[model samples]
Target: MAHYFVGDIQGCFAELQKLLLKVDFNPSKDTLWAVGDLVARGPDSLATLRFFQSLGDTGKVVLGNHDMHLLALHGKLKRNKPSDNLTPLLNAPDIESLISWLRLQPLMRELPEHNVIMTHAGVPPQWSLETLRQESQLVSQALQQADYLDALISKMYSDTAERWEPNAIGINRLRFCINALTRMRYLFVDGHLDFDCKQPPENCTNPQLRPWFDFASPLRESHTLVFGHWAALMGKVNSPKLKALDTGCCWGEYLTLWHLESDQKITQKRLKKS
Candidate 1:
């Protein structure tokens, strides 16, 4: 069985299908790992969510910022934006089931055999593997609980909580966890999260800001870290241990599919509309 890891889909379903076809992906024999942002921006969010939901055990996905935003909208905590292109997904007859499935997906996935770990954005430099697992589970568990889900989703929208505090409790802790796992891109020299910069490393003019992956982490020594979300990275990183998979498919670039064992990259460009 082969393991193929894909970048942020962002509802580009047709392109995803083309990539799968290129790789000759057999769902029965291969497992597909998605770095998240499964819905939004591109067309056909409904179909993309449905296809992943139908994959059952063969598909693995982590939650992205867009996915969390969809949850907030579903809960009436946030308004839908036209740019998100999620109207069809929200209006789908199976929307409840789709959202429920999405909520259960973890913020982090670890493949111990391959010594690989994945999150939507890069893991925080301050967190150890155990801390990462525990913190991720906290949000996932809260999201699965009907009583706490709405309140949790409501409080997850802030960027105020930047630094990680071991003793932090309540909503602040949850917000930090969500931001770090899903929305993080750059960090200040003082080791605080910077949410403002979305440019690629080379183009970033801020001297104080560094891409999150630039910081040294013990986790990188033992395992390869795969992530998506910063589409501007365009599948480039300074270190081999850090894999940036989002190639901006939804932005008219291409989708990337990485074969885990052989380290082969297969890409499919966005199809132009007729």
Candidate 2:
């Protein structure tokens, strides 16, 4: 009867198992919310994906940058950056099926009771929950259709505008998908997406850009939204309403999960550097 939200799992299946055990997670009764990046970088990417896919019932996930990249890269549609440490993943024998299921996952989830909008990077401050859900569905529909991944892979890098007009398509729709599913971090004072900034908010010098949750009213006043893209922000930001769960599990840090109703904390086993 409990709902749990977990941060970026990366490929840390062992840590995920330990954390689930610690929480006494019952698959039949409890729900697990994953903030994506389910595979890549860490060990046992195959195991992690298979384990969750077996959960099969109602494990909700939103695609993160790495997760999307894994799909595109595995499908041979896109090449990762030189800095990406995905050799272990590329070499895994079961990589094909692992990616197929990953690509089938949705890009956003809405919690009815808490009114929590769940996504990997979260909705931009300019977008309301309804607008965000509809747009995400647009992308999801295209993704689920046949030959859509091929289209998405072919036109992955064009449009970058902040506002959406009526029924935009092709690369424009792809841009919405990418922004919602992948590269989101900062929003401009005018509610535009600012993809340039990377430093933590405290160290950030750009006064024009703010986090997505700093918008005017209702969105700010509405129920809390949960997300996990910015590993640098870490977990338990203490915003009272907003919850950030990524604890940098892939980078020798701890994996974190949170309970929606009780505001409780759960931690997975951490890895030690050799």
Candidate 3:
């Protein structure tokens, strides 16, 4: 009945299996909390999607940037990047089912008992817990609505605003929500997203930019935050309340699986080099 939280799998099926074996995970009992990026940039996107989709209630996944991109490119093979390795998945017979399931996945997961919120990237510093939940539901509803899903995914890639405004509406608001929850990493001192800085905090030459968690904000400090977008950090950051899980499994680094209750890490090496 142990809960295992795994980092960006990026379609590393073999490594995922190895990590599950190392942890002795049981589908019928144990729960798997995936920190997103479930598909893309690896050898077996189709197999990975199928496995997770088959998990049903046993597995929970938050949509990562890659997952969203996959949905956006559905029925349009020419738009997908070759490096993403999404062709096999797009060609699968059950591709529609997989895409539908992924669309239904939420952008954030709140673990009430653990007092933690898990997202693909860090939560926005400005959002309160209630606001976060409300925003997530709004976006989730838009994605699940077949009539509005394509339009929402098509406009989600924009990050031009740099900061979120409560008054923002329509595509701008959806883009803001998508960026903060899926692609956020660094932030300006004024709490605006800084998309230019992908380097770790120590490597950043600009004092104006700080890791999202390092910003002096109440939402970040009040509860535990588990995120996985910054592989360059290698799960190292200067915050007791934050846990980074992405170890660059897609970049030929180790796949990390952290046990929430005991803070134990289980790792497996990548089979292919990036």
Model 1 Cα displacement at 14 (Å)?
Answer: 0.2
Q: After superposing candidate 3, which stretches have Cα over 4 Å from the reference?
A: 75-78, 272-274
Please give the TM-score that candidate 1 achieves against the real structure.
0.98
Candidate 2 lDDT over 1-274, as tens digits, reads 8889999998888899899899888999999999888877777777777788888866887888777777677767787654556767677787776667776877888788877767888666656777777777777777777776677755565446555554776668657656755677777786667777866788789989887666664665786778888888876354777878888888888899898878898887576645
Off by over 4 Å in 2: 80-94, 236-238
The sequence of per-residue lDDT tens digits that candidate 3 reaches over residues 1-274 is 7888999999998999999998889999988998899999989888888999899989988989888888877945339889898889988999989988898899999778878789999898888998889888888989978665556866676669678889988778888888899999998888899887888888999988878887666777678888898999999978777889999988999899988878888899898655
The residue pairs found clashing in candidate 2 are none
Estimated TM-score per prediction? 0.98, 0.90, 0.96
Off by over 4 Å in 1: none
The TM-score of candidate 2 is 0.90
> Of the candidates numbered 1 and 3, which has the greater lDDT value?
1
Best by lDDT: 1
Each candidate's lDDT (Cα)?
0.92, 0.76, 0.86
Model with the higher lDDT, candidate 2 or 3: 3
What is the full ranking by lDDT, best candidate first? 1, 3, 2
